[model samples]
Target: MIHNKKEFNLGIALLVLFFIVLFAMFQPLFDGHNAMAYLDNLYNSISKGSAHYVDALKEEAKTLAGYNVKVTMNMEDEAQAADSVALITAAGGTASAQGKALTINGDYVAILNACLNDADKLYNNDSAALKAKYPALAGKDDRQAVYNWYKILGGFDKELKKQEAFAQAKVAFNVNSKVVETAYNYYKVVPEQIKNKIGIVIFSLVFYVIYTMWYGFAILFVFEGWGLKISGH
Candidate 1:
């Protein structure tokens, strides 16, 4: 009986230690009373930044379109006819460039939507829905599904940054032109802080799972050890 009591006390102590370690590991996730708040903030930042960037591109396109119309309307002015024609041609090229930017932005938005959808599915623990929605992930298990979703999000952010850099470079090369300069000035990229936050969010997500698994195994060990002690007694 004394041995059994000692074993039970040890089990309780082990369980307490397990919880302490688990809590320490997941402290970041527990902040603000929302385990996934960092992830949500990261997603929101990306979505809002991308939307604003796309809108700015559209506005730049509209500006060039207007310039094209103006140049065309003033083509009859003999003194400025050559200059007008040149401006019109430049405007057409700039407008085409902006259109391409918009197309790229659309692609980014699509990827972002997929990321958000996957996140929702993960949050709801709807593994079946995730598999159904993403046929490529149909065969993956639950943990794998979560990892794949995270990978997709990380890839999307990387691609978005690359595309943004390319767009910015395009605008910079044409900075001598007023319209291009205006577009360049209006270009908004994801902030560095948000990018760092994404890393933190991903880390927290992965650690959350790891810590939970550890805690479960610790509990199992404690119970098994206590059972052995009781049988011995």
Candidate 2:
């Protein structure tokens, strides 16, 4: 009977250990408060709706800077006329080289079109070209600069659609892709924490079961000793 109990206990411990390892492996997914939170983060990230916009905006600003369009816009009108004239001289008006070459694609549709149409013309990394053109980044290795703005734009749109379908957000915001993506990333950590909790729980339960079995065996041994003494008396 003791042997049977021991075998049963061992089997339980092994099963518990197996499940604990499995949970640990997949813990990050369930580290949040609930499954819904996990789904929300996953959908946002996989679809690239939440973070892509920030990346796109950053890239677009860099691309514009490459064209020598002054990033710091003068707020005061005191310099307006002079600035306008300078702009005309540097870039020209509507038909100027600045206007034609300095493309602004805030929307994913427009960005994608520009990328597709000017694939050969556009550099994958603007910092290199910009440095070569401007001589400012000549010494610095601006390797972090990526010209994959168009790809990011597409990814953001697709991820946004997924986040909307998941209904994680209160309502689908028509704002830029990066804004939503930022929100999604901010909340993603919740799921990871939850998964860790599950791993801990599984490990605890297994140890508790093992402890209980050992305790039961110790009690049985004590009882058998008492029976032997009584028979001898």
Q: TM-score: which candidate is best?
A: 1
Error of 1 at 116 (Å): 22
How would you encode candidate 1's per-residue C-alpha lDDT over 166-210 as one tens digit per residue? 443332222213222222222232323446566776787798797
Stretches of candidate 1 off by over 4 Å are: 1-14, 17-39, 50-194, 228-233
TM-score of each: 0.30, 0.21
Best by lDDT: 1
Q: lDDT of model 2 at residue 66?
A: 23
**Cα-based lDDT for every prediction:** 0.40, 0.36
- What is the lDDT for 25 in model 2? 46
Worst 10 residues of 1 by lDDT: 66-75
